[model samples]
Target: MTDYPVSNAAQAASSAYRLASLDQEFLLGDSTRGVRFQLEYQKAQEALRAYGVVSMLVVFGSARVRENGAGRQAFWYAEARAFGRIASLEGGALGGPPYANVVATGGGPGTMEAANRGAHEAGAPTIGFNITLPREQEPNPYTTPALTFRFHYFAMRKMHFAMHAKALVVFPGGFGTFDELFELLTLSQTGKTPRIPIVLVDQDYWRKVIDWRALRENGMVSADDLGLVEFADDGADAWAILKRAGIDAAPTVNNFPLGGT
Candidate 1:
């Protein structure tokens, strides 16, 4: 006896559409799905490729930082803004001779925007990798035309953020900020990335979340892991850390396309 083959739906999810639902499901045929995905992927690839030579400083922080506030909360925003400005000024006017010619940040509001604004104030090009969110993630107006990007995939975006990140400055924030910080630390810890300087601004605020002594006492992390990050009380110190990392100033002045290096 001869056996017949199963239908396409049984073989693949792409062919999940019912025969009667075909006309209502897609204006383009299922065959176009792979092509469409490839095209979108290429756009993302090109966007990542456009950022040439600029050393990235992924600024992670809260989006809810008040347009106005005081104390630690306010200080976090102020300091991040300052970090952006200093990086740009030193990297641009002072010449990033040994460093890449730009500064970059998450392309959203709060600390990210502050960092971008700081770079813009210093008259240096800056980048903003904005995430697509249902609310509160519009790309700030400060991002330079050639450097701004929007990403649907956070992992892809995070990869790009860490790709050339000469340093990382984490300001006080919520889950998202912490998530970014941990990822960088994990990468460095796992040897997936180099031991770049990781700065956490507002030591007091950060302390509330992590009990360093307990971490060590419990043997949850290695002594080397503890050394992976430094805490800063202000922007001046944060900028100083980056400067010490050979990103202080550079000789060149051209966009190197985002992931080229």
Candidate 2:
């Protein structure tokens, strides 16, 4: 028998010849979109589990908020920071393993940073679920290094938000804040999610921003739909509302609605 070549050089150099797990080109291809989505969930879920985050107290607010400004700007920032600290201490984050109601934010500046900074000051671990934006959102320094995560897909990011959330506290924000708020409300109304206590900080701002009553009056939404939200005077009031709604008193339930499709 004639001796064969030790190996095919062309085959050895081919992308197809590489291991699937090691092939970035293959992993990032359009064909792997589902894989990417799954990986996004898995990576963050695994990291969170490793860090002992049992349930999340998600804070939503304006990225435009500032530490020191005129009137409500200053007020919102101070309250958000206070809420982060209060929830971290009262919600079982500092108690030890298998933490619950841990302070979590979008992992950017303004409200997110203020909240994270509070938890950091409280000596509690905080979470930052950051996303890639055209403007490039970066993680605030206050989130625990081990607990910080970045996501490529908003779907996956929102899934993470809904999956582990025990409660949601919304501060005054624009479009992005509204998007997160209504999605959770819709989910609550549809029973797609278990009861989520949605508290909007600064009652005056929220009422003017969203004419929710108009929706009910015009027969767009049910009269009961208006009851889905609770208003807070500030961060302390938010926490009290969450407690009465049984956010901490109730057992944490992770319901992946619609099978997380």
Candidate 3:
């Protein structure tokens, strides 16, 4: 029997047409419109795979943040920065390490850039999966060339983000940040993926989002559902929790003792 499941020639041609349109718009170059977004996206994904990242920590937060903004957006940036550093250390501790990097916001400014900058400061490769937006989104320069990416498809980008994620560190932000964070939660709650660690930095910021106690009281979610999310006051605390959860192996033996003995 032939491998082709469809024996109808007309049906095959129709399918090909749909794929061709998508290719021209999202996966292939269409020079007629002077847009190479799709090509750039594929290039970025390939680059990230080549950068030796076996797993990644997807850092989600505000992209419209100013260093001196109202609210705690700046603090969120600081927390993400620290989280990136912790991700690098966790990467180093794992056996047969493949150098996990913190995949940041993928934009030039805001918390995404901060995470990438933190990884860069620690001399680690970082991934910035930038999306094409109307404005205020540019690829941060700190991303390692082979670890940076752009995507024409947000869904595809989200898939790639979750693909190699060992953990997720969420910072306080707006709608987009909430969407990404909840989607990850949904996936975990539904058994779409293994129970990886999800650290929500800053209890004050996240406490307002949902009342777990209320959910339990109303029987919407089990008491165990609360276990799905852990809160932290800062980056170091978040790292501590994630490290203990087996997202990556932690160093068991003390390699370097106190002072020169």
Candidate 4:
């Protein structure tokens, strides 16, 4: 094998001469969008698997919430933080061969940061699925460095959320939060995913935002479908609701992975 530097600059500099695997421009081009999506999925999926995250207790809430803001913001942050600690400690995230019910969040500020901080304080590794955004988003410091992930596609991000979740806890949020919550609900309704306990914090807030009875009244969802939702006053209440709903049942489904659904 005669390994020598290329003598021809033109040939070495040509785009066609570049190896496909090393061609960053080509790989990032629109033509390779599918590859990029797959790369995002695999990167996160493999990292989670390596860290033994068998199941997740996913938390959803508004990114705009603050620890010392007006009215309900502080309360929301406190509750979410409390819930993260409870889930991580009691849900089998600590000291496990294959950690289950690990606290997971969207990996940004507000509720996500609160939850991740709680888990970190409890000395449990947590997962955060961050996404690329127009306004920009950053992963919370509390998430385990190896488990923090970033994605370019919302569909893939949501898929990761649902695929590994053993249960879900939702706090007051606007459009993005609602979209994530309802998407999981739709998956449950359509039998696309295994049924998991879903608890909504602050019944007052949720009630004001959603007319649950109205949906049933409107024939949009059945009474049985209504059973899919449980309400809680705060983090402790949410944990209790999950316990009653049996969030700790089966613990090793491998999240079905990114490619599964």
Candidate 5:
């Protein structure tokens, strides 16, 4: 029998077919970043489409607010849960496949947990677009496993959030929340995306945190821009606003494309 050289075995091991997962040099290289982004978008889009997520009610809030925390934290959590429940039940999320107006969140603790928990309680499927943060963001237990997703890029994640959004309910939050809120607002303002109901929960909190009047006064934003956001004191109020905006708990055909297509 002829003895094969050791180099042959090494070369065969490095072949494309054998080195797929081990090809970190190509996978993680800068040249493949766009491919990575596309993969992330496609993966999430396919999963959501399989579940028939026609549209979403995007919920933005702080990950730090707790159910038992002091001041309005508990209230915010409870209200968020209630909103999720109401939206899920009314928005046709629990009815059947091709769920519409399902509650979607950042998939973290605090308000994200509350909203997801609410939808779970309503027996509705929910989506959690979790990100890999240095602080280690974990998907909230309440997120529907079939619809839950993890992403490395914030832009792609945000794209998913706004892609099929039918409405936005923003609770008091920190930088992360603000980032999401402003992104939607900018999209709405510029007509970059379709118009959707935008409700800011807790008028008092929002007024204090964001100087809407000041923004208009400074000529930084137009008066019509201020009209883009509505205030809701609680869950009921938020739901009412959404309803008036034509987002009923009833199921409707989703005209929006999946995965921000």
Candidate 6:
């Protein structure tokens, strides 16, 4: 009688092949990076769509600004929180499905936490787009778990940020905040995106940090570019700017299309 070789478990497993969802090796490979980017975008898009989040009020600020910390840190936190609450209350976030002007943040501590916490206080669903970093940025506890997302790619995350945004309220922050603010400014300047309400809280801080006059004088940025950002000293002021930009403070329904269409 001839002896036949029997297939082992490992061999059988290999022969069966791994499902796409379970195939980490292939998914993480260099060749599949584009697919990963698409996956990241699609996942967040689908989740937000399911929640009927059609428009967003994005808040960008320092992750380092603490609630009880010194030198305007606490003030920034309080203002951001207030803005989140006010926007959610007026933007149809608390009304029902097809939530509009929902508060969104970077999903880390400091200002991000403050904004999300405010929305939570108003009893509205909020979004947190947390990114992976070497320093390990953690999502704030106040963010709605179902709407919170972890992103491996910053570009994809930024795309999501701009996609649904109807307004942007920027508070005092550092390099990361500056990066996001400038990118949106560029988009608005170039007419790459629709003109959305962009407000910088604390005129004193912004004027000192960014010399709009100098930029216009030096011809680095046009006068029109400088007009793109409005200054607001407080939450109510910021909301007023948004209201003037055609965002109803109290809308019966969110008729704005997704992606600001």
Residue 94 of model 1, lDDT score? 31
- List pairs with backbone clashes in candidate 2: none
Candidate 3's displacement at residue 99, Å, is: 1.7
TM-score of each model, in listed order: 0.77, 0.92, 0.74, 0.93, 0.93, 0.91
Q: Least lDDT summed over 10 consecutive residues: which range in candidate 5?
A: 252-261
- Residues 1-261, model 4: lDDT tens digits: 456675676877999899999999999999999999888888888888888888899999999999997999999999999999988888888887588899999999999999999999999999899999998998989999998888889999998898888889999999999999999999898888878889999999999999999999999999999999999999999999888877773468654433454
lDDT of 2: 0.87
lDDT of 1 by residue, 1-261 (tens): 345575655544554544533544552558666554554446645654464444566778887775567656677777888888887777542343233635667778888878788888887777887777877577898888767877666776777667667678888889998888999899888877776789999888888888987898999998888999898889998888767776655443322134345
**Candidate 4's error at 59, in angstroms?**
0.2
lDDT, candidate 6, residue 42? 88
The candidate that achieves the highest TM-score relative to the unseen native structure: 4
- Which portions of model 3 miss their true places by more than 4 Å? 1-45, 93-97, 249-261
lDDT of 1 at 222: 81
How many pairs in model 2 have backbone atoms within 3 A of each other, for residues 3 or more apart or on separate chains, i.e. clashes?
0
**C-alpha RMSD between model 2 and the true structure:** 2.6
Global local distance difference test of model 5: 0.89
Estimate, for each residue in 27-123, the C-alpha lDDT of model 3 and write its tens digit.
3544533245345545655565465455677788878765667778778777778777666656552232355435555455778877887777777
Give the TM-score (vs. native) of candidate 3.
Answer: 0.74
C-alpha lDDT values of all predictions: 0.72, 0.87, 0.69, 0.90, 0.89, 0.87
Off by over 4 Å in 2: 1-8, 249-253, 257-261
